[model samples]
Target: MLNRRQLLQNGLLCGGAAALSQFPTGMAFADEATRLYWFGSPARAERTLAVVKLFETANPGIKINSEVGGNDYWSKLTTMIAGGNAPDIYQLAPSRFADYARRNATLPLDEFLGKIIRTDKLMPNALKLGSVDGKIAGIPLAINAFALLYDTAIFEQTGLKPPVETTTWDDFAKLCVELTKAIGKPNLWAVGNCARYSYALEAFLVQRGKRLYLDNGQIGFDIEDAKAWYGYWDSLSKAGGCVSAEIQALDKNQIDSNPMSKRNAAMTIAFSNQLVGYQQLAKNKIALTSLPILEGSGQSGLFYKASLHMAVANNVKNPELAAKFLDFFINDLEAGKALGVERGVPLNLAVRDVVAPTVDEVSKRSIDYISSIADRVGDFPPQVPIGASELEERVYRPIADKLGFGLLSVAEAAQELISQANRILKL
Candidate 1:
């Protein structure tokens, strides 16, 4: 029997051979099709398989094998790379990109740009996130931005108009308070407080014209920015715009789930990809609006962040073939239409336009809305520094908990967070 590594490599080798026999071009067949290992949830696995099938059909000579695991993806990937068995294509997170790039775990695609791929057509900010140290380490699979999702029926019932394009954060806060009081239930919240969600906090900061990270990967803003952000939400909670601490602590998922779905909250900040789930949960129409700008900010202040789902490893034997397959997967119109935004909003410009006409009503609306505001969206911050992801979870989450629980004033929490984040980044 073959050893584990030999068996795995052999399977890939044979699969590549079988794949090559189906294509006519000898040059294409000369290279072996590459294997991809992904660490994603089971739901994503199912959607990804459909996309892969489409890719295989388009390029019959390319064989792509995917391994799906919900947990231990990073650890498993780390072990595989250590053993020289890393997959050609894999998943990468923004926070982990620098770590991989520093250790030479990923290939830089700068030389291959325009030769094998034209990134010019993609949303400029999305295309930029793939570059690390002036080289492209990976391609963005999707673009996700925060949007305010509201229950249309709740607004109608409360005699409150939906948030308009020109609505300010102050207007939104007043609306939240009015909506909560009209509902007259301690169980109901006007706005779902996801202060623990870093993206939501980041959106608030951005709306205030603050960058989340500096050029050198340092904490970009002073502690006062953080305080202003937390203070807004903390005040909103005090004004009954958010759920009480006891309820928030009992069920964390409620912020994005049934509470909003069942009309317990009038509005919540969520990603473009989550609209589908919200629609299903909402008995009435669910509408999405851009995040409100801060009063007098003058800047729209929203930023586009890459969903950075998949990446290819450098140690794989068939780098060129893997890159080709990725190109097809992201750029193919038919494949994208079939995949929809299951992975997130498609990053490929052509593919997005092609898929837009065929998607569901809600998805179409989302695409249109994002397209209208594309020019206003800024690029994501640089790949987060090592331990940055942990800082968000350990330090930031606890600080948010303290503020939500009324244990720490916004000023105190902001100071602690900045000090802790600076210390972690310094390390």
Candidate 2:
């Protein structure tokens, strides 16, 4: 198996050569067709291929190749980058973007922005997610915001109204209780898993006028915010309305397949991109809506986050052509429509509008719902801290699990989380 460093160097050299050869003869070597290697899931492979085919048709000189895998994508990507054989461009997540940015392995797009593509057309906040240290390190391909997915049939059966319009978190809790009491134990949970601790915590912090990380990459929120947030989940779990500790402990896919989709849970939080998956598994129509806001919270503090997908690589034979390919994938309406939302919600405003009419009904509803609430959504939290991504799984999971199980008091769990987070963040 190739090590990470070696894979990266090799990929970089290939991409660099491809970039150079795109220039006029005598300006740069023109021998090799620009190579763009993509790392993606098998589910997205067909869509990726369609998009690449469009790109190739538009720019006939460049050659593109894609490699598809599921579950092991991160491991493979790391190995490829470390081996210096990285793709000309590859997918990246917001949670992990800081690591690549800090290491200088990815190209910064600021130097070539308008020259290659019009950066001005992207939503400002969406554009900002791909940037680090005031440099645009990658181009966002799609945006995804957290939303509530509720079973409309279940709500009608129980005579319970889904929280459609904005409501307070306190009201949210009451609804969970009402739903749970009406449905009975194990058969129906008011809420799904609370095991997505980091995402949950960030949502709380943003709603409360705080953030997980400062723009400069330092820990941003205080212990009080963490305490209030943990307490929120603990209270709900204690009420037996949300998924219990036993259920939250399962891996995400397991939870999604079992309780959430089985209609054991009346509602759950999910990304906008998950509409297709939920539709396939859910027996009832899944209603999409914005996450409940805290009472009296101002709209200025809320904003939906763009999907974490961006392209960056350490090696490329043709940096310019690679950049152009990235730009076209995001900005070209026809190309984006062909790929659809396989990557997430398209980050390009023009592409989103172009494809909006053609998406599935469920997907269109999700997009429309989020767009209606876009003004209320806050900025995306700063790129997750170094080691923060791992810490999310290691530190936050136990606390959430403990609270869900009723084994740890909210106060105790809050205290423990703050101490651990501070130690990890060096705050």
Candidate 3:
């Protein structure tokens, strides 16, 4: 009779517990063995369960108790940690990791890196994404960057050439307008979306050689930067190159509701891993392209965002075993082959090479997409400031929604965002 929130808070879901009972390793492991609870989204269950089975076969003493928490994972994890019952090892988003690290709820992985973690096998940027305050705080499983995913059919029908390496943001916006007018469908937006919260805006700053927040715990970019970024998207929104606020609300921004999925949008901006999910929903062939850049932009604002991380909780009973399991998860070839970039492409270079041949055509496209702009990518962003999470979900997005809805002018929205973000971070 327990609801999802209650089940998640207790580290067990009703049907979820039943589902895990069916995993090959679920029931047989001894109680005395090391148990690690993994918090992951339900959408990630199938691939994660597959990886767990392989890990169990190779290492019998470690019993991984996995739960598919869906969107409740983070909220429940926060509650558990506050109540002194954090999961032994759980998946964390890079954006939220800092808040956890700042609170000392996450354990540092420095000692385990040399002994168990294969430091030489990971990209420096990949390694840094998991670090907070100079301490390696998590074991990264996969990395990705936002990309332009275009529907081949939509482009062909509209007679617009497919996107490529040199496509600038201006070119992309133009294409959006061209496709929308050519198709003559009011609902068919050119870009799936042109407005989003700080994550999307942060990409703009990165493109302009700025960060969202400086390491000294202050707002990273200027009012002009915010103005410019907001203005560009607002222009697209006003021109109908992007979906209107009402259409976005109707679609709820789900992949199924995206114009790209319905052959309505010629292109959409999304994380590389999302290409697979979008492909699953859309009948047309979906392909990945590098995010559009600014003219003369030296290196891109792009960095390999950690798709997910496995962090040992500070109160974990067996840190050694947790670290060993993490090392095995990342470094083992079989595990990599089993995962096959489902988690956002493997962060481990060795694993990438090992899993390369096994990927489906879509995954090969993603691998190629990441490699195409490899040299253009810039530095890892600093850890999110303490008030940053609130700034994103609460302050930033509401202001962005206002801009998209035409409720606020560019100057007004941009200033409000700058002032609010600065005040939040300064605290």
Candidate 4:
């Protein structure tokens, strides 16, 4: 009986031999095909499809059958893996990298890194993000840092100073209040309820020298930290700094639905790469700024994370072709120009340098913002544990919604959240 890794290797060699035999160089085989899967907005799908078309034109022998845009992407991927039909190449999030890599669902690309996939120009942190146990399971296509995106027009009109790198969370809340009062609009708000987001919560924890999960896969922060986090958001919500619960409930929690994007709020906490898409949706001029920090914290807790990784399945029939596509996607100047920052800043520094000048002002700012944070941001935290996503979607967001609606007090919400996280993380 072969183990999973051995089986994977066997599949690769046998599949490659069979594929190559059927479709020798000069002519394309009618049945040669591979699948690519990903989930994102229409803009992301458009940009990705554009690049896929380029890849196809360049590699006519290989055909890519693509699928995009589904709310149940992870669930569908899990089903595909179980059925031995995972996409040959897919977009993998850092949060789920450990889960797929540990299960041997993803291909290890160590053999191809320098030989097939170019990495000399790739950012070191971006490389680290796709690795687990020293094996490269994915190639980070782009990088993103946490940021506060605000409408510059709103700030200018209100005569308010936008958030700076040094601005504390306390100061951020006050600014929200000031902005809300100055605007004096019933429907419009200063900011969204950021506490309802896992990234925002993680940022808060990291600023205080705690992490969402420790290296050992246990819950990192204690009850006190949880209380402080929820309490802060609850206070902000009540103080009219954040959108009301009704308005927040209507939000679908994506780039298009975000308060700032909808023009219902002046600010939002979002990934640095999202500025481009957000700017397209928002009427006001969208600009990126540093996330509010914990006062006198040990570190800024801001770190560059792979927005998403391009991963090849371990059981892919055409591993070599997938590797080639990965190389082109990461290093090709034309692909980079087409992608812009919709997928976050390019992880390949050489590509970024060339692409930055050619992109829109919003995208250029995003690239510059990422560059400006090199010295201040901390190291990327550990690969989010197996149950981390569940904790965010199942435990964290629901509890945050309850707190926002005043169904649960801050103490109650914190206690419930911590207890659920501990149980889920097996701490």
Best candidate (score: lDDT): 4
Worst 10 residues of 3 by lDDT: 17-26
lDDT of 2 by residue, 163-223 (tens): 8556677898888988899876665688875544576567667777788777666666776
TM-scores, each model vs. reference: 0.86, 0.87, 0.89, 0.89
Q: Tens digits of per-residue lDDT for model 1 on 87-130? A: 67888877687768767898887766666665666766566778
Task: List the candidate 4 regions with Cα displacement exceeding 4 Å.
Answer: 1-33, 296-298
Q: Write the per-residue lDDT of candidate 3 for residues 1-427, one digit (tens) a residue.
A: 2334654565443232223321232234344244444544343554566666677667755466665555555677777777776667777766677777878988999998878777778766577788888898887788888787888877788787877767788987787777788778756777755555466667777888788888886888988998888888889887878877765544444567766776556677778888878888777888887777787444466877887778888977778877877887888888888778667788778889988889999888888777777887777778777887788666776776788877899999889988888788777
* lDDT of the candidates, in the order given: 0.70, 0.68, 0.73, 0.81
Better of 2 and 4 by TM-score: 4
Give the higher-lDDT candidate: 1 or 2: 1
Residue 407 lDDT in candidate 4: 94
Give the poorly placed runs of model 2, Cα more than 4 Å off.
1-41, 253-258, 296-301
Residue 370 in model 1: lDDT:
75
TM-score of 3: 0.89
lDDT of 4 by residue, 46-153 (tens): 576667777777776666666663677788778777877777888888778887888889999999989889888888757888887779889888999998898899
**Candidate 1 ranges beyond 4 A from true positions:** 1-33, 39-43, 250-264
